[model samples]
Target: MKTRWIWVLLMTASAAQAEEPLGCVEVTVGGYKAPNYDCLSQQMGNNPEGAAAAQKNMEAMNVPVHKRPPNQLGLATPAATSTRMGNTFGTSVKPQRPPN
Candidate 1:
């Protein structure tokens, strides 16, 4: 039973190692190694078609400004009761009258 389990583990490990990433050319910059996105995109076939598909998907998911529903709770309106311009400051400075 121990030998069978060991054999199965080795086989699974080998199988996992056999499957490598299609793209992913590692880029080294300042001792930091990361996958080159451009190369990966090209290798994985995400150049133009993928971008277009993504854009279309985003557009489909988005709700246009004009099509959105009105604010039911009136949160969009100003909280202050006074409509005067100077009243916006909460009595910090009174609105001055023009001198004749």
Candidate 2:
């Protein structure tokens, strides 16, 4: 009887893990471009001690992430209000920006 209970529990755990077939979902950025990297680098202070540091820091942390708000720990400042993950698969797009 104890063995039966154990087997039942094991099967339950295994089935729980297999609940989803693991399909993929993609989020498309229809046409988003606001904070430009090239321009940002220039604005941040384009030079050895300025732009270089920013570039290195960005790369070190694996691309700059826009924060919704400055971290309470004071590690980073607030910028973008949201974030997401997964592959951004798409073709090369040459988008145009109108007068702002």
Candidate 3:
């Protein structure tokens, strides 16, 4: 009975670990080593030094991501412009800017 309980506990522990997100690659960015980029970024974001290091790592890798505003986090559609700036030289009449 005791062996059965131990086996059950071990199985449960293994299952829990298996349920965790996989495919996490070990990365050393900005001299900080972590299991994955997400963890590294989150930890690094806590301090100015870490943030700078993370940014440096990102720049070195040439994969910089711009920080987005909270409101702009979701999928966004661009606002429509009143006039499309078509080729100016293509038109016969030259366009003139109106003074404010």
Candidate 4:
């Protein structure tokens, strides 16, 4: 009888786990937050069309960071980096002129 009860409890636990919904995740792109399509599709039972429509609706709701108008100081545009070398500790400070 104890063994049978243990089996029943295990089965019930597995059933509860199976009924739990899949975890959906969101991602930020171009300063816009959108639901992850792969996760959404899984949550929607792998329905590609439904996931696509949902993604479209989510994207339509917000303008991406790049598309927004420039700020008042025109600093919205990112600075261009022609050289890959970044400022290291040695180069960060200029050497003081020798007691000029």
List, in order, the clash count of every candidate structure. Answer: 0, 0, 0, 0
lDDT by residue (1-100, candidate 3, tens digit) is: 9999999999999999877353457878899876767855655555778767888898877642466543354543333121332244335354445658
RMSD of 1: 12.3
User: lDDT of each model, Cα atoms only?
Assistant: 0.68, 0.53, 0.61, 0.66
Candidate 2 per-residue C-alpha lDDT over 1-92 given as tens digits, one digit per residue, 9 for 90 to 100:
99999999999999998774333333446675444455455545535687677878887766345632356435533232222111221322
Q: What are the runs in model 3 whose C-alpha is more than 4 Å off?
A: 22-35, 38-100
Candidate 1, residue 74: the lDDT equals: 38
lDDT of 1: 0.68
Q: For model 1, how does the per-residue alpha-carbon lDDT over 1-100 read when each residue is reduced to its tens digit?
A: 9999999999999999888566567879999998777766667674668788989999987878676654543334343324433443465556444558
Error of 2 at 51 (Å): 44
Worst 10 residues of 4 by lDDT: 80-89
Mark the 10 consecutive residues where model 1 has the least summed lDDT: 72-81
Candidate 3 residue pairs in backbone clash: none
Q: Which 10 consecutive positions of candidate 2 have the poorest summed lDDT?
A: 80-89
In angstroms, give how far residue 99 of model 2 lies from its true place. 31
* Maximum-lDDT candidate: 1
